[model samples]
Target: MTGIRIELSRRERAILRAVAAGRGVLVSSCEPALTIDGCWCDHAAVHNLVEAGLIEKERQVPYGLATPAVITRAGEAALAEDPRST
Candidate 1:
């Protein structure tokens, strides 16, 4: 990986960690929902991660449905680069 690094808030970092651990999902709804093991997570943080292209749905799903979230290459890079991850 390159030396490029991305800054992330604590919540965003937690969400990324959860997704990397296979415990996160994105539910498509009137307001998209992010969940970890069926528990709610901060919407703003989830949205921010998605918008930043660090995480994405694992597969396509219809509206009002849920799909597993997967960390993107950028996400992996971010996790690897984050000092807090150590």
Candidate 2:
């Protein structure tokens, strides 16, 4: 862990949980899209997670394609800290 604490909103936390469950992806296009189980999720929240280094794309794909989202070490740490995780 980087020892940096990241704060997440309820929505972001849910999104991260979904990603951690192998149900999230980022579709790269003119407007990037975040999806969970083939359904749309909060784009801004996904952006926030990515920016915070909590999650990332599993691999590079074509411009209009998508890749699986993987939780980072920081992401796991954040989930561990979730109040509901106790």
Candidate 3:
């Protein structure tokens, strides 16, 4: 299989690492479809991550409900490559 390289900022990397650490499952805001570490994350950052194929938004819940952010295999690979990640 071909390999993919995704360059992410410190925050983006940390977000992906955290999500991956959670076993590829993370609760995100429903309406905004954001929030990485309990706070609202940059919309563009989230979009970039998703576009990079590292992360994906799960089914959308109600307006006040929380949704899930799932880490793709590519996300796991990125986290594995991050030396600062645990």
Candidate 4:
């Protein structure tokens, strides 16, 4: 996981778990729900995941937040690295 940086904090790992459990289009809320802790939407995670090619952000026109990310294959693969995530 060379290009994949960061030694994830405990809370960060939990957030990743929440993403994994997300179904449908994985449209997670900015505010975490029952299974997720809301505070995890930090810039650090978004930057790192983007750098690692594990997620993507779409520029929304006439919609909600201009840049919201949906998980990618790399993200699922990254999550698969931890058994707790799967």
Instruction: Point to the candidate with the largest TM-score.
Output: 1
Ranking by TM-score: 1, 2, 3, 4
lDDT of 3 by residue, 1-86 (tens): 14666668887887787666553333444323456556776777776787787887666555566657778888888877767766
Residue pairs in collision within model 1? none
How do the residues 1-82 of candidate 2 rate in per-residue lDDT, one tens digit apiece? 7776677888999889999999998887765578999999887887788888888889889898999988999999998877
lDDT of 2: 0.85
The residue pairs in collision within model 3 are none
Tens digit of per-residue lDDT, candidate 1, span 1-86: 45656888888898999999999989876665889999999988988888878988898899988999899999998988899975
Clashes of each: 0, 0, 0, 0
Query: TM-score, each model?
Result: 0.88, 0.86, 0.68, 0.48
Cα miss at 23, model 3 (Å)?
A: 9.8
The 10-residue segment of model 4 with minimum total lDDT is: 31-40
Task: State the C-alpha lDDT per candidate.
Answer: 0.87, 0.85, 0.67, 0.49
- TM-score of structure candidate 3: 0.68
Q: TM-score: which is higher, 2 or 4?
A: 2
The TM-score of predicted model 1 comes to: 0.88
Superposed model 2: Cα runs more than 4 Å off: 30-32, 84-86
